[model samples]
Target: MHVAEEQKPAKKSSKVKWIILLLVLLLLAGGGAGAYWWFFLRQPPAQAEQAATEADKNATKGAGKTDTAKSEGRLTTLPPFLVNLADPAGRRYLKLSMDVEVNAPAAVKEIEGQTAKVRDAIILLLSGKSYTELAAPEGKLLLKNEVADRLNQILGAPRVTRVYFTEFVIQ
Candidate 1:
């Protein structure tokens, strides 16, 4: 009975020692990880800039071309559209002048070639809108987006990035 009682305390001490050792190892590992992160992972601004430049060089080398989307797109002015807006009294008229931002300069010739179709589409779109619908800023923005979307459909691609309302008047 006496020996058994003594061995029980020995066994408890061994388990306690193991637990303490495991905890110490875990703490050391965490400290090492924090130090590594502080020293290596935290980059200075200059190093970050160099890394970005290196990545850009690598990307350019792989692509062998500049990005088209970042390019300064060309603008094309469409002929003015004098359309009759839909109204309950049937006397509303809208004169709208627009310029389109085309992604490629070559698209200007394409747009000029399809000028009749573009004009017809815009005329139909504008003539369908009632005076009240064209009265609000939201309505004007909607009109711009709709025009861009339709023109993109004509090109079968998103060649138009933006639409400008150079002139908008309703009478």
Candidate 2:
């Protein structure tokens, strides 16, 4: 029958549309999963653990071998800094704890020797920032770079290559 033929084509078209829609949805889900893995899970847990172990060994062993530390990198932890932000309300404060990555172990000793000066410089810089200035990700990154530059200046060498904020809190 003519009507039956028309109904069959309509049913086929409807099924095709559903199949296409399902495929599109599957593609979108796959893309989202891929992006999540790329951003958050790119580093495997085993690799991170191994790197941490290596860092510990380097820290302990390179304390006496500046050449080894210089060849690679050394992480030096700094005492946490708690400073009042230069906000209009004067009610905000930031508590930050970080590790400085230096090119040499001598830089670590230099930082330890100049702890007072280093703390002073960092405190001043941190206190000069307003709450809004350090609230965004870009602002935090800028602060990290600025802190590295300041540390290098204090050390009188371009030793401080990176600053990793282990704990950052602004309130």
lDDT of 2: 0.92
Candidate 1 on 83-148: residue-level lDDT in tens? 998898989999999999999887888899999889999999999999889899999999999999
RMSD of each: 12.0, 6.7
The best candidate in terms of lDDT: 2
Candidate 2 total steric clashes: 0
Over 16-54, each residue of candidate 2 has an lDDT whose tens digit, in order, gives 999999999999999999999988988788988988988
- Where model 1 places Cα greater than 4 Å from the true spot, the runs are 1-69
Give residue 164's error in model 1 in angstroms.
0.2
Where does candidate 1 clash, by residue pair? none
